[model samples]
Target: MLDTEAFRDRMATLPHDLSEYARVQTGPASWSAHPHAEELSAWALEDHVDPALVRTTALLVDISPTDVPHVAVPHADVAQLVSHREAFVVASINGEATLETMLDIVGLPSGELLAIICSLCARGIVALDRSHRLVTR
Candidate 1:
């Protein structure tokens, strides 16, 4: 299982607006890049599981039971961020967002992001090191 605390902590380091967007959008049924989302969705649909339950289950993919307080993103900063894609990109690269998170941050769809990430990983622009963290060389 993915480490929820670590995941949330990493996400917390993103700019405030992005973090809030992530938190508000997060729930059991919210979309996930996790490999399990499709299978879980299919099962829920086929079995007629309560949509709420399905959503809750989906939220479990990245949520931790332990509450970690999040730092607020100032409105002014968020406003500034709206016009600064370069800043966001730099921050993401510095923060080491996973290929999936990086794609979301850059507003690319999953397929395209996956392709780019795969290509970069292959070329060693981004690589998983001994700690399983993606790093740029």
Candidate 2:
């Protein structure tokens, strides 16, 4: 038999926000996303993904099983045909490559790619290394 009374007691003791997702700024701008809000990640930026991240950021393997996880938009439920342009960015992040170098080498327009990176950052799959690389944390 299920213990409904016990379940109610336990639920009452827990904080309301226990499962609440944490809000994070997508960039210096007003964009935001809740990494833990849903089973699948979703990012909703205001105007666009920040460019400075592209200028000064490099991605490191965080939640990826390998140094490079398939460079998708963090597996979110959105539509934009954001292809795997950042694979080079992720593959080259040997803790030595810089953001500018990735952009130059990949040679793709930086907007969608940057958004994908920022989405990864927001989702906690990757983080910006202070030493100028992305990393798992």
Candidate 3:
């Protein structure tokens, strides 16, 4: 079941004015400076909320799912990750894959996978293309 209270609390913490953060490209298709990037990612790692729902909420809060960004690991070292699932997701990326393809390759529910991706993205470990870098997902 979805935890509405926790979800709302998380949402409340996210930045309302994303324009202030300014999308700065630290790596391939990454927006490292987004206000919600780090906070959201950290929440995903520790929060008890459903991963799939968190993924959906993340999209709604930052970018819409229809945007379907391409994702990739910017760095080679992902050994520091504590969660095996997160490490697996990082390993599964070869070059850049669509968010849909990543979901398939990682074999994790969308919520879990996306949360990991978001966390990596915040840490400059993964890059998510917000623009039309790859149209087909």
Report the Cα RMSD per candidate.
20.3, 16.6, 18.3
Candidate 2 local lDDT, 1-137, one digit each (tens): 99999888767464466432433433333323444544322442333556644433434333221223233334353223323544444544544444555555566676654556655555444355444335659
Better of 2 and 3 by TM-score: 3
Off by over 4 Å in 3: 1-60, 63-76, 133-137
What lDDT is reached at residue 86 by model 1? 33
Q: Please write out the lDDT profile of model 1 over residues 1-137, one tens digit for every residue.
A: 99998898867353445765766778555556667989877875696776545544443343321212121344345445333533343344533444445555668665544443333333323333224433459
Give the number of the best model, judged by lDDT.
3
> What lDDT tens digits, residue by residue, belong to model 3 across residues 17-123?
66535554333444355768888778757869876566545644664343344334334456754367767776676655667666666678888777776776655
What local lDDT score does residue 90 receive in model 1, on the 0 to 100 scale? 34
Model 2 CA deviation exceeding 4 Å by range: 1-88, 132-137
**TM-score of each prediction:** 0.27, 0.32, 0.43
| Candidate whose TM-score is highest | 3
